[model samples]
Target chain A: MATSIRFDPIRLPPETEVLRGEVRAFLAEEIAAGGFDPRGGYAAERFDRSFSRKVGAKGWIGMTWPRQYGGHERSFLERYVVTEEMLLAGAPTRGHFVADRQSGPILLRHAPEDIKQDILPRITAGECTFCIGMSEPDSGSDLFAAKTRAEPVDDGWRINGRKVWTSSAHYADYMIGLFRTSAPADDNRRHGLTQFLVDLKAPGITIRPIQFPTGKHDFNEVVFDDLILPADHVLGEVDMAWKQATSELAYERSGPERFLETIEVLIELVRVLGAAPDSRGSEGIGRLVAQLHTLRRMSISVAGMLAAGEEPMLQAAMVKDLGTNWEQALPGLARDLAAFADSSPTNRATFDSVIQNATAVAPKLTIQGGTTEVLRGIIARGLGLR
Target chain B: MAEADTIVVDVATRIFQDLGDPQTVNNAGDDSWRAPLWQALTDSGLTLAWVPETAGGSGGARADGFAVLGLAGAHAVTLPLAETLLGGWLLAESGLEAPQGPIAVAPTRHQDRLTLAQDGTLAGTACQVPFARDCDSLALAAEGADGPVVALVAGHDCAIRPGLNLAGEAKDDVIFDGARPRLIAPAGADRDALMLMGAAARAMQMAGALQTLLDLSVRYAGERKAFGRPIAKFQVIQHDLARLAGETAAAVAAANSAGAAIEASERVDAGLLLDVAAAKIRVGEAAGTGAAIAHQVHGAIGYTKEHILHRFTHRLWSWRDDFGPESVWATRLGESVAAAGADELWPTITAA
Candidate 1:
């Protein structure tokens, strides 16, 4: 595909329809043998370790990674295919997702050789998982203003600080963290920060789950009470955490997942409409269907840019901001449509679940990733407004 | 390609920037919000743009026209430019010379009955005609059991009960009672198809209008001061204006993509319809946000009809509900996707 989308549509050469038979069989075996539920729990957010390993064993995990790293070396489009299937199945890929999709790559490019060789293979094999630790007490959007300090001590460093909004910190084995290694207020706020690979089991580190109003333990507050790390744990270079953190964020923030989150409710709304939807429903369904498709293309295009290593920051922001609205609307609209009833039980259940989830966390979608305001600020800058 | 597209948008920007010029907008009253500017557009082949060269038209595409009109909408043009352009094209395409001056074709289904006398005298009455008094000719749907016919009746032919659209465009309850009708196109034609075209035109125009309101409101927020600094310096206003700008941009971009696809295909694609509907939803959303944001930015002046901000906001406030609301489109889109399921979804979605 040409770099710019003008007349032609993009055909991601690697995309496959994702055969249901194969996925079903693999999932069946995992359910029967690995003993996992497709819908794990009420608010299942953790990655199923045994299930993930089984999936990784099935050559599903890191399908897009290079073969040398114990991966199938499938294309990003192929990875997208697998991802959509997993989400639709409500499978627990969350554990390895960060590692397989994001961190492993971050390590490959910026991590020291020892860390990459050790972590990447384990991640691909589903033997390891990683959590992100960036946001601090006082620093949210101004993340570079991190107050977490690390002092060089002999052949290692001692770290002391608190981190909030650290989701999955309780379950992950390793954390990709940003700690201030230099003195306060370095001239280059961007450079004073440094990323470190911290072992979650390290001494003097405490993890406390912050229960949301929804009673979900998805996010946690973790504190480091002078935890020690070896010299080799540093990613990239000392006082260069900002660059590594930036790359990790670009990976975390943009993806097909961002836009596809609300699709469950969307599909449910359609199924309830039955074979022949009334003209009113048809208009509404048709419009959403079209937007989902258009945004998917735009997002896939962004993913392609990432696959080729282009820093399409503004484009990603555009997708996320627009994607946020679609994601948020899924629940409220589903509830309204479902209120009509007369839908099949399966359709109702699907709609009900999606609505429940959507209603609970729709507000977070805007605030998470990045607030709507921040994304627009980025977009305005892209449009040369600032 | 992106750069060139930006340049086209730049042309629109230039048009809006000229609004402060002594351009007889206030005098156009409801219709002349920016008449001189629109006239400039016509001179530049912006109006009558959807017509083809084969029929003495601008030979320009509707999507291009949509882009231009969006800017015109942003500038708060007083006249019913889209109705005229699209309605005129329908008449011209139906083998009728368009009304040369100030015309508004219904561009809607109407046609209770059309009867022909032995002397080739055509007569019929349409239920309702848009901007009827403002139009020199009215293009309406002539009644047909099989399918509706395109009947272009001279404005003088019908006894019109003129009224106003919610935003003040002239709407008339047109009575063709024993009146002569110019048979433009045959009966039993594709009303559904033509309506889609008309709808597409309306959606693009509305999208433009919403976009203008959003831009103006954001600019106001940035320039207008409250307390100490520009009001935009506050996080709340910034957030509101930012959201308005983002969603409006999305709507504009979405509509542009659909319009481009339609222009490329030349035939109505199901996917294109989906795109058009989605654009409608976004346009409505932008209008809601845009109007509210505009009002908030303009503060007290926005509520007063005397203020120029109301000119843009009023159009946005009304146009947002016209055609359809976002909820309507959302449900439609949900249905289309559900009908497709997982297998058909990839191709249907990725196709566009």
Candidate 2:
């Protein structure tokens, strides 16, 4: 029999509330200083190095890591507060988001001492940026099928491959590239793949922008001819990147970012609807808010489980699957709810712009991180269906 | 959960396991198991779990009562356990003593109203009152001259038109032409507060039912054979079951969070309203999606009345309509969110 899934009703502690207030005050001050626009989509995708340094100065970046590594040694929940507040305010967080969320933690756990000593401090100081190089031309969801080769040399590895759809690579200082070290075994296709931390400024490396149809320049294709990395750059064991790749996913999949991506549109929809909306409008808004709240609760519960040292991989997948789908649908739902709103020029323009941007971004939410099909497969394994 | 909450849930689970097993009750022809189940619930004080000891009933934490309700839902019992607990809670909130046998609360529907007249008689009709005909007494909320009042009235005094929900449980239309309350007191909670509380309870029940449906569907998929292999081996079935599991997890998380919020709150304020409303809406949606996926996984066997799946699914469908449907709660919640405007939406959500 399949056992029940437990969510434990985890509530944020009083300290988290205190931290949230601080974050809000900081964001408010930044907004007053014209650092970013809360209502505009421009800030969400933009990387502001100075803003990231200010956030790092506040000890928000790598807040959950050790103090010796320039971290504040705070709780994960506290870090959660800072992250969510930034996302909600549409702050320019793209500069340090990937490093703070996944790369920093991965290095903290799996990297060697010298690598950690060299890179961890820069990440915590928000002076560096990281991008994931997991997907290739034919290896998007099936990551093990990556054709990138890393041949061993004297005291280093020569990597030669192409990584497509690599976010932030154009401005990133480093890329955590997965490479094929050997041929896959007959029974284990996931073997022979290795994770290497590569400096993007290295020789024989090129980054070409892959512009979206929305005219956004966020993604890039990174080409490597003979990129060399020292032996210490490899994360965890060689040919065992698959196992290491999954450990950070629970953290990656179940954060406020997954659901809050297009929340501005929903907020804009409510503003357009005014106070006394019709039953249809009210019902639509209500269902969307309810769904958002539920996703947040589930995500927080997963965070709590992580804090308690439980690997709730299945629950995290569920959160990402449901949260991404909900966020992706927010634009359409908001469009429908705002159908009968007053046709004032200001209102129409604001709603239309917000919805248009959100709609353009919606398609990538489900496809990024882990695809919906892959997540469901993970959940099926959790359910013992496979 | 605290230790006391765990003990309370354990007691309720033990009682349900002993006397309220779904398969056992479904296989039986008559209503023989109902009395023993009620008696066991009463004996353990589970029926009056929320009433205060000062109000002549066993007192427990609100979280404990909610946890027990989840257990009751998992068992898919047809008894009036949830109704009685809500009734006792109503009476306790008004500083009135709860009566002995099974009790039902009136105004289960959000818009249903009862009035306390100058002559101390209760009037107005409460439609779709759960277990109205089966209960010994009714704990009702009525609009009084001062404000909303809670009244305890014998079930025999009022006229009840028999009705049954999709689950085949009592859902009668109760009319109070001039029924005199045995005891009436000033209620601390208003109509909206009571509705929110009741909605939260139903959300928990739906969550529990969704869990059981997920488990049954998974088990069936693992056992049922197709194309010389287990049906679960098929990628399509695995995906469907995975979706069902996701829906079930969402419902569980939402309901549990709402219950925890209610327990932590001093009163039914806007924060609690947000939690309860969200829980009700999300869990109701989950119930609809989860039941369909579960039945699909079970195939024809799950469609039959003889199967235990419908017992839970039927109640899941019926309970979604109680207190307030998804649309009703959604409208209220939506109006509030819109009124708060775009700038305050994140703050309001983060507060909860």
Candidate 3:
């Protein structure tokens, strides 16, 4: 059979357009009120609790979850608009973004009802923060090679392992981590890992900053030294995280965050170039715009598929692979275009700062979430090559 | 509406499969298959798909006609289906009745220009006009003293210089030296609108061709063996195919999005311009990247004329240059975005 990859034309519904206007207006107001700098290059890493709370109060956090669990019960496309607006405006979403995006959804799907009632509400209120603990010092892309262990104890579990490159772990209130619950069954290498909800406040937990080369500390080494977790903290079926993890990937890998990471550079490039640019500047900007628009359309189509409850894993992977590469390349493209541009001193300074930060962070865009290599493998599998 | 669209696409696909099969057409020495395929397409009312029922043509939705163009690309159809559909639409839009049989549009290239004089004479040359040699009539949007005018001129009235694109399809240069048009009327559209439509059509076709390339590459990989196993098992070949799939997916997504955007709106505004321009630029890039990867994966066999790979790949190369190459559209789009200012960029994109 031929490998069929479908991304049907899915325009955001009319209601989402209404939500988009509200989001754009809200973002404008926030910028006006000095909530966060729209020029900030890495807004996702800039933690701002008050801003997240303001966004939460607007009913955007956990917007797609069930209403009973502090969600607004909105569609994913609505959440998509809100998410994209925040990213494009460079709003500080670090405080509640993880919880709003993936943690809450996982809890809704697999967490106990009482746990969901307790934590989901706080997450929705943007009063809580969450971090993902998947990659280890040893196991990066080969997830099944993780050495993290969680031994069953008296009415609880004792976890011991170190998760490197854990974003927001330094300030996060909780971490949804994967720990080896059992050894691999003879045939299945991905069998042992099990997911658990680890409270960061619990004893025997340590978080150390992993500073970037630019001296900015956004990631952390989350060391769980015999960290105790309640029996109820186990999420989903035991020894079945392989199945659970794949489902969340469609959500994790395909968001606007993947593509718009370095949008400030493009925006600044346009600012630097000014109106009526020369052919060189204009053509460069035009190709970038065309590429950006294409990626957005593909990403939105994936969102619509997700909204319709279709698991577009392959399409989502394709989006991230293309989106991250595009984003990573944007700074370089901007620098090239800006060389020919005549900008005012203030605009030139702003452009320099923006492009510098973007170039610094460019290496991680393809490496984070899932590496380009890993994503390509997934796509190959989808193509019936494996 | 969706069901009807599916039926229409299914019918078109089936007809292409029966009459325009790539392998069959590639092996045939003569142009025998062209007549049957064009006849089947005409009998199905697909040639004038974009024209309204009141305009003496098929009244299919613009979206469906665009979809058929994509199928045409997949089959490597040698007929003037896209051009005829575009021609009929141009005539219909200007309240002019479309003539039957194959029709071709002029000024296929962005740099080319045609003009209509005050004395009702058509002047100037349109280079690389697709299927102009065989067109019964030519529909053109020429720059007139009063804005633009749509004109229908018989093919025999114009001086023709035979040319061919990479796919060996007929793309001729037509010179209208004071030739009087059979019909002329005021047009609400301009050259840009016509180019956008043409770019959009080519983008869809390139996207379809990319899909076929991917399919062919995958099948070949599974069957072609090296190093004691099928090359499909090789990590490098798999990665190549994966990248090809990514390129194909991007092209298909962008093309479908553009087609849908054009269908959703009545006018070609800034939003629609972005959609069409992006589709053309991105899909054109994909056609290049995707064709290379497909060839690399297929090895030497794909390079031969006996194989069907060139049918799609060659067409992709030719189509990329048809409606203002990527550089032209990119510059136009970039200038517009810059003119709108940085703050307005996000709003403009979101609005689209």
The CAPRI class of candidate 1 is incorrect
Encode model 3's per-residue lDDT on A153-178: one tens digit a residue: 99989998899999999999999999
lDDT on C-alpha atoms for all candidate structures: 0.65, 0.89, 0.90
**lDDT (C-alpha) at residue A196 in model 3:** 96
Interface CA RMSD of each prediction in angstroms: 6.4, 1.0, 1.0
Task: Write the number of the candidate with greater lDDT, choosing between 2 and 3.
Answer: 3
- Winner by DockQ between candidate 3 and candidate 1: 3
For model 1 the local lDDT of residue A106 reads 72
Residue A266 lDDT, candidate 3, scale 0-100: 89
lDDT comparing candidate 1 with the true structure:
0.65
Error of 3 at A370 (Å): 0.6
Q: For candidate 3 chain B, which ten residues in a row score worst on lDDT?
A: B1-10
Clashing pairs in 3: none
Tens-digit lDDT track for model 1 on A1-386? Answer: 00111112233552365443466567666667746665453222756788778777777777776777777876766676667666655577777877876777777777676777777888888889888888888988777789888899999899999889987888999998889998645466576778888999989799999987888888888899989999988877888665554544555566767766556666667667675676666655666665665566556656667667677676677778878777788677667655765778886776677678768877777777677777877766553345
